[model samples]
Structure formats: structure tokens, C-alpha cells
Target: MAILATGQPNLEAGQSQSLHYDDFPPLNSCSKLKIGTPRLPIVPSLPNERECKIGLLRNRHVLIGLELQEDFINVMAKNIYYLLAKDGYLYTMKPLIYDAKFKVEEETTLTMAWISFPDLKPTFFVKESIFSLATAVGKPIHLDMATINKTRPSCARVKFQVDLLANFPKFMEMETVNEDTKETKIERVKIHYDRLPRYCLHCKVQGHAEEECRSIHPELHQYVARD
Candidate 1:
């Protein structure tokens, strides 16, 4: 359940969507995956739509109805997938579970991204341990194949749900104690994001950063500066 929004051409207001379930293609199939993306003549460089299982799924302009897989339901609940579509950006892909209760214009703070923890101990590379470490940032979704199989010992990469509004910490401290001596030492794990979405601290939105948003809120900026 997601409400498709756009920066190029905002979604039309008062547009209503219908919900329908078909008895085909297996139960809980991702339905909106098939909806023909209405052509955007302005965004000429946009690529043709294809099957996409990853969260990079992008759409814009029109309101769309979706029936998502169970695996994706919770993950999409409070997330926005910000993207750059060839010539320009598509702005957002905000999911509509709880947001349905509020005005759809409100932006969600959490967005999905892959983050890496470098030089973590081998024991901590397991899914449970990695997920535990990931909580310092956000909820962990899935682990990369390399991390799962220990093919990549250098670091552990995971798809995570992170709060865009929160100030991100560069490193996490872990206390490790020797089994016999009980001597504890603090270990630091570095956090690296594969991609960071553009978020405006001024507008509290995902579309753009505060510098680009000063035009819209010049008076507000001036007021803050005086303080």
C-alpha cells in the first residue's frame, strides 16, 4: 500500500483509487507492478518499465493502487524510495499504511538504503548480530548474499530502514569482553550508506536538501538566522 508522489508533476488532487483482488498469479502478488506507467512526455529520458523485485520500484504523476507481497508489507509501511530518473528526480515513493490516516502531503522520515559495517567481528556478521547492530541506525530488512555466506569478510551490508530526519552517527561502539579474562574493550563499527536520499531539513521533506529549499522558505531562513 503506497501513494505515488512526484516532483516533476505532482500527483493530481482529489484523484480516487480503487482496490481489487484477482484470483490469479498466486495470492498476495504485487499488483501495481503491472499498471502501465502513464507516459510522461516531459521526462523523456525515463526508461521503459520492467519487472522489478527490488525496492527501487518507481512511479509518478498518477495515484496507483497496489497489493504487495507479505514480505514487502511491513518494509513499505513507513518508507520513501527517493530516486533520480535519468534527466531529473522523481521525488518520492511514500507508502500509505498509517499515512492514510493523515493528510497524504505529510512526508515520512524513514527511507530504505543499504548500509555497510566495516571490520565487524566474524561472530557479528550473522543475521541476528548484524540486525542487532543495525538497530543503532534503523530496522534491518535483508542481508546481501555476500554477507549471508561470509563471502565478504571485510564488511556486512544490509538493506535498512533509516530515519532521514535523525542525525546519523558515523560509528557504533560495541563492548567486547574476553571469555576467560573478562577484560572488555570497546570496538567501533563504521557506518557507510550505499546511497543517501536527499532530504530537506528545512521543509522536513525527502525531495531536496535545505540549501535548495531556501527559496521556498526565505522568510523562515531569515528569521532563524536572526536568532
Candidate 2:
């Protein structure tokens, strides 16, 4: 049902070349579709390869004949596990079914899932919880602090704030107390400035006031001198 574009001339465009599914034999199984046929050596019969391909296509809702690497297939299974693991029923049910049905290599798939945790931010809570449970049950986990920090702010915030406070209460001032004390005595004081002399004001000096000035005002000086 899927059409793959081969980037060749179309017969409808009068180039006398067209390629379609009809032109080629139906691949009886996905194993028959090999990668790098002549350039690289052909892959020997990959056990469960067809089931893997079918499972990927079905679970991911992707078209068949989409070229996929082994690593990509592994990653896809892990991602699916991460996405579905939070759903209680799906977590318990689907992985077992998926594992049994697809025959996914557990160590490889779980490792792939763990590595993929950083990329799947939306499912970080579920992934982290699952990881914690696994670690509690004595499963070895390679914790990526940077990846977890990058993905989950809530977890990071709780780690930096609450856990740190719990571990180092003195440093965080968690139990410190503040007390208020009473004061008994009070006093008041007045402030004063030294008085200035009068005549020095007419000469524009700092020690004098204006009222008793010896230097005449300009209008007064003019009238007095005229007199």
C-alpha cells in the first residue's frame, strides 16, 4: 500500500521508465529485503528478523519496506516500552507479550530503553520510576545525571531542593530559629549649630549674618553717596 519514490524517470513523463511494486517480485518476507547487496556481503538468515520487522511496523504504525538497521529496531522497542510502561496494565502486560512475541533481546532492549530516556522527556516520570524500581530489585543501572537533568525539571528541582535539604539540614537552615529581644532604656538629644557674625554676611563670608552689615546695599550706597 505504500509507494516508495525511487527518483527515476516516470513513463508517464515520456522517459519510458517507471518503477512500481508490480515491476518487482513481492518480498515473501522482510528478511529477503537485504541492505547493501552487491557492495557489502549479504546478511545471513537473521533469526526472528521477519517478526521484528513486522512487530516494528505494526506497533509503530509505519509502512513496511522502510529500511531499518538492527540498532534502530532495538531502539524502537525500547522507546515503545518507555512510552507504554507507565500505563499499569500495559506495563505489566505488553512488554511480556511484546518480548515473547518479538523475541527481543532483554539486555540489549533494556539498555536501548535506558539510553533513550533522555530523548523521551514526556515519559521521564514513568521511565525514572521504572528505573528506580529496577535498581531497587538489584538490577544494575547506569544513571545519566546529565540526561535526567536535561529531561526532568521536576525531578531536578526536587533533587536540588528537597533531597539536598533532607541530607544537609544545617546547610539549608531548615531547623534554624529566629528570636526577638526586648530593650529597656531610652534617651533623647538635641542638635545645634554655631551662630554667625553679622558684618561678614555683606562680604559673603561664612561667619556672619546679614542684618548688621557694614557694607551698603547697592541702592542705599548710591543714595548715600549722592547725598
Candidate 3:
């Protein structure tokens, strides 16, 4: 049995003041009873009420009784539908996508590829040179260009620090000027992104996957089932 505390002064301390229930035993079950904090005032039910009200849930719908003279509810409902549509739920026309709220937002260290095709020049893979390319998307924290064994190293590794708000781009384009004409030419370089060893979608943290997440939420199952 659960014991809830009320502000009434006559009730004994640590004693439950609930109506007598038939199932309740004369003695506390296991000689232990759960007690909650002090009870707050009742929530206001009408709009235009200045007083704050605790949120109430009825049939999975939240009712706070806030005042909004405009057609805000309809617009908010449409916005919610669009957000769900991105997951391929009501509208199956578009591909399924994850909501932005579930994205990982930590500063991740990633290796980016800087390549100059057809010609592998060691000068093109210098630390200073790759730093400029990494700066376009992220902070150029470090650079490593000593992995090449060929006469000309077309590919270089750049240690880029970035926050993965969404999926990172696989390919990147860099421009190089010709020696003879001095004209600029664009080179399509590929990015060798590193995946985290484990990622927890429920906690939005690395080093532990969703299956191993300790603080998993009940609503996570609903989102997973929808996906």
C-alpha cells in the first residue's frame, strides 16, 4: 500500500489519510508503507486563469488549461503531424527519418579524408594544408599526413572535431590550381568517418549502446515500435 502526505493538520505524521479500502490489511503490508511528499493545491480547469496548474493527463492527452485566444492548438496539431510524418507514419510517401531530438550532440573526434586524384603530391597532404580543409566544417584540432607510402600521397588524414547534429557528409570537394594554366580544379574527396564503438539512443551517449542503457525510458519502446 502507498501512503501519500496531505497538508491537513489533523492527520498524523507519516500516516496515510486515504479513504479506507477493502483490500487494505489491518496492519501495514510487510510492516512498511510508502510515503510521498506534501500534496499541492488543485489545478485550475478554465482558460484565462492566472494561477498555475499542475499538468493532468487524460487518455494520453495532456490538459494544462492554458489560455490561447488564437488558433494555436490547430497549428500545433499540424506541426506535430508533420513531425510524425517524417517518421513515415500517417504519410508513407517519404522515407523514414529520425527526429532531430534523438541526435547525438557531443563533440566527436573524426578522421576526414583529403584527397587529390590523378596526382599524389606530398605537398598537397601537409598539416597546414589539411587544416584549412577541416576548418570548413569543424575545428581543425590536429592533422596526420604521414600514412602514405607512394611517391605522391593523394590521401591525407585530418583529425576533425565536430558535433554530429545529423549524418555527416560522405564526400567533400576541394579546389586545386593547375601549375601551367593556374586555373582552379575541383577534386571530389571521400570522407572516412569513424563510427562510435557503442551509441545509446535512449541516453544519447557513447560507449554504451541502447540495449545496455541503464536509464531507459518507457516511451522509448513506443518510438522503437513506430520505427
Candidate 4:
């Protein structure tokens, strides 16, 4: 069974997502992740006052429901994949849309990538400082071990969870001190991504580029030219 849409397709964070429901299978069933159990413990019913509802699908997955039509959600859906657990098992959930006007099938632009700061001021390599600067772009996950230890002095690398839908600044303005004179200065520091997956600006999906997007350029599909 597939989730289909018509007219306009939409998947948003503040929305409920239905899933294929199945009683937990043995860990061997999922050797890749080595997770889940066979025990199908009773799930207590949700409180009448509280929102967030749940339902089973094809007895394969469990999906949540809410009051709003878009399946209202107050917290991020990804977090639920890690945070919300029953009997020490995290709830399996489909990735939700990070931005409006897309579907989970295409995936949200949110991604984890290593961003490098070329010739970054060494003094700012500290966690607090790195995080402070990184926040200007996105959520900082961790600093490269070499960066944390200041072993690799060429550049500082930090893994961040960034939204690909937004523009990435080539330079980040940072305050630093000059050797010639003990004065504060805001310098434009170069920011580089060690590597990045393709992202389509036209379709607003991460994986392929805009020019390579078939949806934006349907002619790319035409093999025979018409007169």
C-alpha cells in the first residue's frame, strides 16, 4: 500500500503521519539495525485531554493522529524516531517534511554534512565559540576530533544538521583580534562544505540538482524531437 496524493501534495512537521503497523518482530528479522522485539506489549490509550493519537496500518507499522487536518504536530517528527520510546524501544516513524510543499517520498532538505571553515581564527576553535558561529548557519552536531584538539590547523571542520532548502552563505562574518593592533575586527571567513549531496532547488528536494530535475525540465525525458 502506498500513500498517494492529488491536486497538491503536502507533508509538514506539524502534521500527523500514518505508518504500516506490525507487532514488533524479532531482532533477527532486522539484522541491518539489530533492533525491535517480539513482545507486543499493551499500549495504554492516550489521555482524553492530551492530543496525538495513534493507529495501526496493515499490522505492519503504527501511525500517529492528531486534531488538525494536516495531522498537527508540536514537535519534530525525527526526534520522535529517537526520543519517543515504549519499553526502551524507539518508535519507528517516517521522516516528516522539514519545509512546506513537499512529500516524505522526496525527503526534506534537512541533511547532515561536514562544513569546513577555512583559515578560521584558531582562538574560536573552542566548542562554545564554534557552536556560536555554527548556529548562524544550522545546528552543530560535533567538531572534528582534530578541530577539538586543534591538531589540524589548516581548517576547522564541524558536522552540522543544515536545511538545504535555504541559501548557504559562502562567507560567515566573525569577530577576531588583529596582531598588528589589539582591536576587534569582523572578518569574512570562508565556509566550505567538505561534501554535499545533490539538492534540487526547483523541486525543493535533497538528492538531485535543479538542472537535473525531471519535474522542472520534462523535455529531458523526450528522446525523439518533434517538428
Candidate 5:
């Protein structure tokens, strides 16, 4: 008697469709499989549009926040670069204006004195005299001038005077000579008090201090020593 198993295909049909053992021994079931070349990962480009939008938003905010006067803002903003390049300081406030008389008085108090030169041509002689006098006393002298009249006039005379009392005794010295003696013998002389030895203040005393003055300050009696 013959017996048949269930769900099994006929052996002759299976052999006709499958690999033949004699032909290449049928590829091994556990052989390594090779895949095609792998594809590289893709990297998206940066979003330039988003960056531009952000920049635009920031600029708008700055413009909106700058609530300044139209003209002033325009001047400052438009000229800022040029002004910064040219000037050291950013802003310049208004300057204070005062009368010329006040200014002149202030200057005079700090200055020696103002010399008047009526004649412009003779100014050379005046300048020479000032230079000589200043040099003789070893003091610095500065010359300055101003116009008296705007229009033309007749004969012009240069009247120049120095502030001999500017530096007080420092720039001047006074000396007195005694000519009472018959033979013109050396007698006692009086030297003036001065901050410096100039033509304004000088002492010419034999045995006394030149700073002693009875008219200026009587309390300075201690400075006078009688022999």
C-alpha cells in the first residue's frame, strides 16, 4: 500500500523550479549581502530671510523710540557721523554773552594796565621805552591796544601808560638821594617797599629797613630800629 503526506509538493516539480545542487552548489544561505553606495545626509541652508526680518524690526524699534524734534533729530542723526569725525565733543550748547565793558574791567583787574597810543606812527618809540623800562627792572611787560575812534581824526598822538602798580612793589623800586651835605657826602636814603626790585619801589636807607612806612601802616613800628 502507498502513503502520501499532507501539504508537501511533488519532488519532481520542486526540483525543476529550485537551484540545482550540481550547478554552483546553490549560493550559501548565510552569505554576506552587499548594498549599493550609501546616500549622504542633507544639510539645509541658513534662512537669510529670517535674519533680514529681525534686522528690520530692530531698526524700526530704534526709529520709533527716538522721539526727538524733527529738525534736531534729523540734524543729529544725519550729521552724527560727520560731526563725530570732525569734532571731539558730541554736543555744543549755547555760549554766554556779556557786555564788553564788564569784560574789559575784569581783564584790567587781572592785567597790569592799558597803554593808549594816540599816534600809530610813534608807537614804535613807546614800545621801545616800555621794553627798556621793563628790562631795566627785570620784569615782564605785555603790550595791548584798542581803537578810540572809528572814524578818522586830525593829529594822532600815542599816549601809552604802564600799570606801574600792577605787580605792586614786586615790579618797581623807589630810591631817594640825600644832597644836603656841603661836600655831597653820602647821607641816609629811603628805599621804597616793593614785591620786586623795580623803578616803583626801592630802598636807599643807610641803617634802616626800606619796608618801614609811617603812613601806610603805623603798626609796623617794630620794623623801624633806631640806632
Candidate 6:
């Protein structure tokens, strides 16, 4: 008793005719044979009433449906990247022509190299007076005098988180007391930032030198050399 299979043929030499289904080995006979689930493409299901309609306008613009609070919109506009809100409208910062062009503002945190001309004592920058002046440029988050190299004790630096609106003046005025006259005199000291070499003292690595290995606290805040 034999039956010809639709597509499978005999594998023996000189035999080109279709073989019977029974002539083939049974699935149970092959110990290595394994059945697998068929691969199917994933498709997203349609949204229901719980899902608000959200779409893009003009390919790039976003159209958010549902009533939104003013405070929520403002916070979203400010916190989000490359987005701005004006007159109760949320807009993206791409395609410059979409709105009035302006410098996209952001907060920058960094540890900057601070060296006072004549190299005032490391305590000079930490003084309340000097700190106030420093804040005039940026918010002084931390002062790391301990990181100052023993060889370069006068070249200590501080980490500051600055607002974009702050002013980083090239020179700062330092009020000094004259010895003989006992009079107050103002002297200007030139300011330099991020002039130190980037070398990791802990790991002996180049590019990033820190009090501790940056590999451990990779998320620690860093500053831009130019900005």
C-alpha cells in the first residue's frame, strides 16, 4: 500500500518519482526532531476611550489631545528638551522657522579650574565675600579644596551649577586692605576656567582625572571645557 506525497519525492539515486507518505520516517521515529511555534509579526491593537488621541502634525509637530492645565503645560515646556510654550501653545524647537528664534537655554554644572592672579590662598575663593562674587556668575554648588594637587596648592577649583542668564566675567574685583594706610583698595584678578589637564589620578587614566575613579561614579556631574 503506497500513496504519493504532494511535493516530497524519493531521495534514492535514479528515482525521480514522488514517494509515498508512509515511506518517509514517522515524526516519532526521529528522536532529534523538535516542533517550534511559527513566527508571526507583532501588530499593535487599536486604542480605546481610555487612550487620548496623540499625533504628529506636519510630520514633526505634535498634536496633543485632551484638555491640559496651564501649570502642567508650562512645566512640560521648560523641562522637555527642544520645546517651548508661548500663549498657551506647545511647540517644538526644531525647524527654526516654526517660531521666533532664541538661544535654547539650559543649566550647566561643572567643576571649573579657578586661579586668581598672584594665586591668592585657597581660602580666598571660599570666603563669604568671594563666594558672593562667584555667585554673581554662577551658583557655587561645591568647593573642592582637597582635590588641589599638593604641588599646585594655589590652583584649587570649585564646582558650580550656573544658570544660563548668569554672567561669567573675565575678571573679578577683590577688595583688599592697604597695610600702611589701613584703607580699602579694590584690585581686579583675571579669571581662568578649566585650564587643568584631564588626567585621572586614581585610575592613572587620561581624559578624566578626579579625586576618585570616574568609572565608579560615572554619573557624577561634569563640566564643559568651553562653556
Could you tell me the lDDT of residue 132 within candidate 3?
A: 52
**Model 5, runs deviating above 4 Å:** 1-125, 136-142, 146-167, 170-227
Residues 1-227, candidate 3: write the lDDT tens digits. 11112311111111112232232112100000012211223222122234323321222222232233122221121112211222233211111111222222331222122322233245555544555545445544444435333334656665544544434444555555555675766555455554423546566543565666657744544343563
Off by over 4 Å in 3: 1-121, 145-154, 178-182, 196-201, 208-227
CA lDDT, candidate 1, residue 117 = 87
Q: Mind giving the per-residue lDDT tens digits that candidate 2 earns over 42-98? A: 222222354333322232222123233332333223212221211222221122112
Model 6 CA lDDT for position 125: 37
Better of 1 and 5 by lDDT: 1
Worst 10 residues of 5 by lDDT: 24-33
Could you give candidate 6's per-residue lDDT for residues 1-227 as a string of tens digits? 11112322111111122222222111110000012211222111112233333333332333333332222222222212222223333333221101122222311122233433234444443334334444545544334445333344555455443433233556655555545566765445555554433545455432354655557677775967994
Local error of candidate 5 at 184, Å? 14
Best by TM-score: 1
After superposition on all C-alphas, the RMSD of every candidate to the true structure, in Å, is: 15.3, 39.2, 28.6, 16.2, 52.0, 34.6
TM-score for each predicted model, relative to the true structure: 0.54, 0.15, 0.35, 0.50, 0.15, 0.30
Which of the two candidates, 5 or 6, achieves a greater TM-score against the reference?
Answer: 6
How far off is residue 48 in model 3, in Å?
Answer: 62
lDDT of 5 by residue, 147-227 (tens): 223232321222222333343222222111233432322111111222221221332211123355434456875665789
Candidate 4 lDDT over 120-223, as tens digits, reads 77866776666555666676666878999999888889877677766666676555444456566655667788666677877765568988889988988868
Output the worst ten-in-a-row residue range by lDDT, candidate 4: 25-34
Among residues 3 or more apart in sequence or in different chains, the pairs in candidate 1 whose N, CA or C atoms overlap within 3 Å are none
Q: Candidate 5 versus the native: TM-score?
A: 0.15
Candidate 2: residue 54 Cα off by (Å): 19
CA shift at 214, candidate 5, in angstroms?
35
Question: Can you give the lDDT of residue 148 in candidate 5?
Answer: 28
Q: Which stretches in model 1 have alpha-carbon errors above 4 Å? A: 1-102, 201-204, 217-227
